[model samples]
Target: MVDDDDLILEVAQMSLEVVGGWEVTTANGARDGLVRARAEHPDAIVLDVMMPGMDGPTAAQALKADPETADIPIVLLTAKVQSADRDRFADLPVAGVLAKPFDPMRLPAELGSLLGWT
Candidate 1:
């Protein structure tokens, strides 16, 4: 997961680890997240839309542009919950979006569904 907020990252990490039984690595910003994602190649990425240096859409584009990371699924998590915002991501190579202030309890399930994980 990549988020500027440490609290969100921590909560997501805990939820995915404890509840989802998944190994998670978190980065505080989009740049770091991209670096980590490149190195680690996680099963799925949960990215925040707003961040310092390289927002989620731009980062997602870069990741998709790269053949090595192109197949990895990206799920955007953001507060930009507008109709246009949803439409903006329609053509992007994202798996889905999860709105901000999400229920921590259901995050794992949401991600699982998005990634088609059983």
Candidate 2:
């Protein structure tokens, strides 16, 4: 998972670890997340939309544009839940989206369904 907010990261980590039973690696920013993604080649990525430098869309675009990482599933987490905002991501190679203030308890199942893992 990658997010600028420290609390979100911590909470997400705990939820995924304890409830989802998944070993998660987190990054504070897009750059670090990309680096880790390349190294770890994780099954999926949960990315925050708004960040200081590279936002989720841009990072996702970069990841998709790269042949090495293009196939990795990406899930965008955003506070922008507007219809238009959701439509804007239609063309991107994203696996799914989760609205902000999400239910941590259901996150793993939601992502798994999106990624077609279940």
Candidate 3:
């Protein structure tokens, strides 16, 4: 998971770890996320849309651009709940888009559904 907000990162990490029983790696920003993504090669990425310097879409592009991370599925997490906002990613190679302020307990289920994980 990658997010600029410390609280979100912590909550998400804990939620995924405890509830989902998934090993999660996190980065605070898009640049760090790219680096981590390359090194760790996580099964999927939970990326935040709004951030300083590099946004989620740009980061997803960078991830897809490199062969090392190209195949990894990306699920965008955003505060923008509008369909138009979600439609912007139709051109990108993303698995799905999830709304922000998500239920911590259900996050794993939602993400798993998106990633087609049992």
Clashes of each: 0, 0, 0
User: Model 1: how far is 62 from its true place, Å?
Assistant: 0.6
lDDT of 1 at 53: 80
TM-score winner among the candidates? 3
Clashing pairs in 1: none
Compute the lDDT of residue 108 as modeled in candidate 3: 95
lDDT tens digits, residue span 1-118, model 2: 9999999999999988988899999999999999998898988899999999999999999888878788889999999989999999887789889888978999878778888987
- How far is 11's C-alpha from truth in model 2 (Å)? 0.6
lDDT scores of the candidates, listed in order: 0.90, 0.91, 0.94
Ranking by TM-score: 3, 2, 1
| TM-score for each model | 0.95, 0.96, 0.97
Sliding window of 10 residues with minimal summed lDDT for model 2: 107-116
Compose the digit string of candidate 1's lDDT tens values, residues 1-118. 9999999999999999999889999999988988888899988899999888889999899888888788889999999989999999887789999988888888899999988896
Question: Any runs in candidate 2 off by more than 4 Å, and if so which?
Answer: none
Candidate 3 similarity to native, TM-score: 0.97
Cα miss at 58, model 3 (Å)?
Answer: 0.3
